[model samples]
Target: MFWFQEGLCCLPTFLVVWSSSTFIVNYLIALFRRDVDVVFPYISDTGASPPESCIFGLMSTITAFAGFATMFARYKYLQRLNEITGGVSPALNKAALFFAITSCVGMCFVATFQETAIRIVHDIGAFIFFLSGVVYIILQTIISHKAHPYGTSKRVCYIRTIFAVVAFLAAFPTIICAFFVKETRLHWNPEDKEYTPHLASAVSEWIVSFTFVFFFFTYIQEFKQFTLKVNTELLEFK
Candidate 1:
């Protein structure tokens, strides 16, 4: 039974982990491109140092592709879940769709554009993802409390609610920090004119990073709760 339960959850977790890993790898590769100096001579002055050409660009491209694949997987997963559950809430479904679209767009843009633009869009995408995650968890909590046959105790419901709230609150500071961080720049002309979309990109990255960390911890707790519930159900059956 544990095997069956894990099999059911494994695909989604794998998709998320793979997508995230690709993204990080790509970001690291872009950080060290040799042509970075030629493209943005003034990068040093702005506190953005050029990195050695590495696998980041390739990784980033791979990440983009993986993200798109994950989006499709997520859609299919939700669709099947809806069928099993008699239908998901329209609002939650819509929100999930929004996040899926935004994240895909952001990843595509990051692959095609310069770092600054990519940073800005990525931040927006991250926020959408964070928002969607929160909504899904909340809606699930509500459904579990109201409908689950095992009967959710009031204490359990309250604890879940508090955890969700704390997770949501962490997003704000993360976003704010991302907005204020420095950005990578590229010079267009020989006049050494600087054009870096620093403020937004920096802040976005900071916020996304912080938010991801917070969500990671929150999700671990959520997973524990889910496992506990499943175990209890299985024991009762035994």
Candidate 2:
């Protein structure tokens, strides 16, 4: 509990680090592998690469662990929002927190069931995570706008809103390329051939992931003046 409180504030920022670093590390590792190239888009266990698969699992574990702590911090933001809004709706933040945790759990599923390992579970997890992520962003943006206490100004919320939209909008290109593009390629193995990930899809995926990271990073300003104590589960923005 003490440790959770002490490190809770850094979890979201660390997520940006971990996810981005994982991408770089996994990409570099893939560069050395004979199976895939730097151009692969289905980055999150979408293809058959061992280290990349491991990286996906690692990312899920990382998200869940960090999310466990950061969710509390996120809840506090909502609580403060309630305070500013005269406590008009008590359940809103709670529901938002629930969705945030659900998103983390989805990441866990994606991690545990890599595409090659369990396609059905992987697909389900991906869907849940995607939906949860978008909703979480929407909720957080609302909360941030309302929780104008501490150093969180309306301007901060506005900036966050823009980034959140960027993160959300960035997904469209990837989705479109995924559905419409025919990424057919001859297999390295003469016995078999299959469709590789499209370049547009991969590039769009990068954009989406990077924008998502930036969107979360906007919360650091909100968390900057916030503090939490373990013994009482108390949080305050000084």
Candidate 3:
């Protein structure tokens, strides 16, 4: 039997692939072109209104869709938890759902107001996305510990716990570097033989982004039971 839930759950995977691919491809090209700041340039900078702005914009659009799908998936996951925990889902599950939704909205806002046209709104959206993402991961780590109605394996939960911790740790520094780092200027020293900026927020930002996306790997176990409902009508979500 076909399962809409399985498809829905996989939306995050699609998000990971599409968004990552767009950045990786553009960043590689940008590296050779070196037209942008490279390190300081936000991901949205890849979509600056010129030759490849359209390309990056396309990626942002894809990310927004992925974020929307992820929000829906989180809602469904929370509902599943409610069923599993005897109609009393953990508070964390519901809270995570809300944060996930906020992150989705942030993604859409960033895409709609790309930095070139509206820098402040874009910055605000990026902050929302990153901060809410950390909160969502922390909540999910708590949720994964409960004995899920879907019989998600303990092993899977442990894996999630590990990833969640790493992701949260990674995300905080990204925000710190973005906001508080006073040294944005590049530094050169023959002692270290490295020409780099004192504040390399981009490095931390990429780590946060990749780790956050990887954190979604935890949901694979939760999606198993969505396979059982043979009723097609139920799949319609009506």
Against the reference, the lDDT scores of all candidates come to: 0.44, 0.65, 0.65
RMSD of each: 10.6, 6.6, 5.5
lDDT, candidate 1, 1-238, per-residue tens: 5532542243335444654655444344444543333332321112222331123334445555554444444444445445666445545655655655555555444444444434565456455555554554455456435433333356556665665566566556545544544544433343432233333333334344333333333232223222211233435553
Off by over 4 Å in 2: 1-8, 45-47, 84-88, 149-151, 173-200, 232-238
Q: TM-scores for all candidates? A: 0.46, 0.76, 0.75
Off by over 4 Å in 1: 1-17, 23-54, 116-167, 181-238
Return the candidate ranking by TM-score, descending: 2, 3, 1
Which ranges of candidate 3 are over 4 A from the true structure? 1-9, 37-41, 87-90, 148-151, 180-198, 227-238
Span of 10 residues, lowest total lDDT, candidate 1: 40-49
Clashes of each: 14, 0, 1
